[model samples]
Target: MPRWFYQLASPRWSYEIMGKLLPWFAIVTAALLVSGIVWALAFAPSDYQQGNSFRIIYIHVPSAILAQSCYMLMAIAGAIGLIWKMKVADMVAKSSAPIGATMALLALVTGAIWGKPTWGSWWVWDARLTSMLILLFLYLGVIALNSAIESEATAAQATAVLALVGLVNIPIIKYSVEWWNTLHQPATFTLTERPAMPAEMWVPLLVMVIGFYCFFAVSLMLRTRNEILHRERRARWVRELIEKQ
Candidate 1:
């Protein structure tokens, strides 16, 4: 195993690393989110087609992107826990559930809001929409399963299996617009294609996307740190740290 892997396996080291990283992620999330919102809403030019209503893209796109990314991260964490039996990985998998769920919900609501003006309907059983809903349910199911199991290790194991199974839905969600005759538009940004809009518009969107990721990291670390403390409360290092407080 790599030196870094050993370092990560140490709960004390993981806790200390997160403690150092949390503030940086928090600061970047706040700065980028605030600047991205202001620039996207006020300064960025509106779509020639949708006009002011298209402003919702600033929020909808980033959240939608983050929703999928969060699930991917959560599942990866679960896989790490399952394979290596790493306690920190389990904590990460558990911590990420609520954040992923919230991102999915925000994506759904914002998509609905954006839809009302563009698609002439607030809700639709379109492929992308339905698949995103499924993603939310998957996150919820993981949380529920974790809560239902009494043994922490057993709960983590079960949640890990569920998360791994749910990975199939992710690809479906990604390609739904292309694979199905959906009302939702195709991706505006792709690795193989240039952006649909000019730099003025897409730049802030890029910032927003990066900010959302930073925000996710901040939230995951906060929750994972709490989980570590809770699980390790009886340990000498943790107890000593608590006594110092």
Candidate 2:
């Protein structure tokens, strides 16, 4: 709404502001992650049902949430680039692919780790697991497409189309537990109902989720800034900005 806020929509200004903000976000993320890990691993009481295995939920859930969110955010960026011819938006979408893919990989691996003793299997074809695997494929597809193409613009366009098409999977992943019988448990954290875990258990999970989001934000900004510089290397404004820094 404000003039200054709108100015941030500009890639040059966004990079500058985000560069200044990155250290603070990094610090906060480190603090939150450390506190959350300590609280979840030690201070929080073990689950009566899963014992120490439930502690894996903190990392798994948060990474899964971030993985999904980052995909959606990247899709939105792709849409903006395609619709408005925004170079910055395309750059952002490009930069976000690896990070989103990493989060998805973490979510899947952590989920598998939590599943082994509880489910008696390392993998499952259940709805949630199946949908998540598809999500990972989508991330890989986007990243691979980005790298395979020669021209950045053409790559961005291809990835944007792929991301837009992949958007259909997001809802499927979110609602898979509700829609079908699955080995995977339903949402542990829900906005509308009381949490399934006790305060001690869920609180650390909430902290970890917040920390994951902050870390994602910081990563996106840093990656996008690098992209902005790489693309804008010939711009006088970029040269001036670099000189000032």
Candidate 3:
């Protein structure tokens, strides 16, 4: 392994690095979110059909995307912990669950709000909607399982297995719109093709997506730092850190 990869296993190193990076991520998140919200709500052209109601996409789309991305990160972090016995990875996986759950909830609530305007109903059994709901439940399950176990290592192992098993749901969520005749629309952005929407609208959406990612990074780092300190409270470095503070 590279020196940097080995360094990542060190809780103190991970915590220090996160502390250093947090400010930058926070700054970027604030800038992009503010700019994106302003550009999206004030400047972007309204959809011909949905009109002003379409502006909600700025929030809905990014939250939905972030929820999925957070799940992936959680699962991957869990895998690393399982494979390498890395405490830092376990902390990251543990920290990710609540944040991911919040993002999923935000996505679902926003989706319902957006759906009410577009589909004329606040709730639907549509494939995409149902799958997204499942995703949220999966996050909650991980969180519940983590808290249920008394041993920290045991809890990490249990949640890691659950997260890995839940990976199957991610693909289902991604393809639900295409595989079924669902009321939900397809993705707004894809790497292979230009967005159907004009530049003026998509630009802000892009900014919002990037901003959401930065926000997630900031949240994860903060949470992970806390986890590290708690888990390593007995360590000399943690004691030193506390004494210095």
TM-scores for all candidates? 0.98, 0.95, 0.99
lDDT, residue 63, candidate 2: 96
Per-candidate local distance difference test: 0.93, 0.91, 0.94
Give the range of the ten consecutive residues with the poorest summed lDDT in model 3: 126-135
Model 1 CA lDDT for position 82? 92
Among residues 3 or more apart in sequence or in different chains, the pairs in candidate 1 whose N, CA or C atoms overlap within 3 Å are none
TM-score, model 3 to reference: 0.99
Q: Cα RMSDs of all predictions?
A: 0.9, 1.6, 0.7
Q: Which candidate model has the greater TM-score, 1 or 3?
A: 3
How would the candidate models be sorted by TM-score, starting from the highest?
3, 1, 2
Superior by TM-score: candidate 1 or candidate 2: 1
Clashing pairs in model 3, backbone N/Cα/C closer than 3 A: none
Tell me the spans in candidate 1 whose CA falls farther than 4 Å from its real position. none
Task: For residues 1-245, write the lDDT of model 3, one tens digit per residue.
Answer: 89988899999889998999999899999999999999998899899999999999999999999999999999999999999999999999999999999999999999999999899999989988898899999999999999999999999999999999999999998999999999999999988999999999999999999999999999999999999989999999999888998
- Model 1: residue 125 alpha-carbon error in angstroms: 0.6
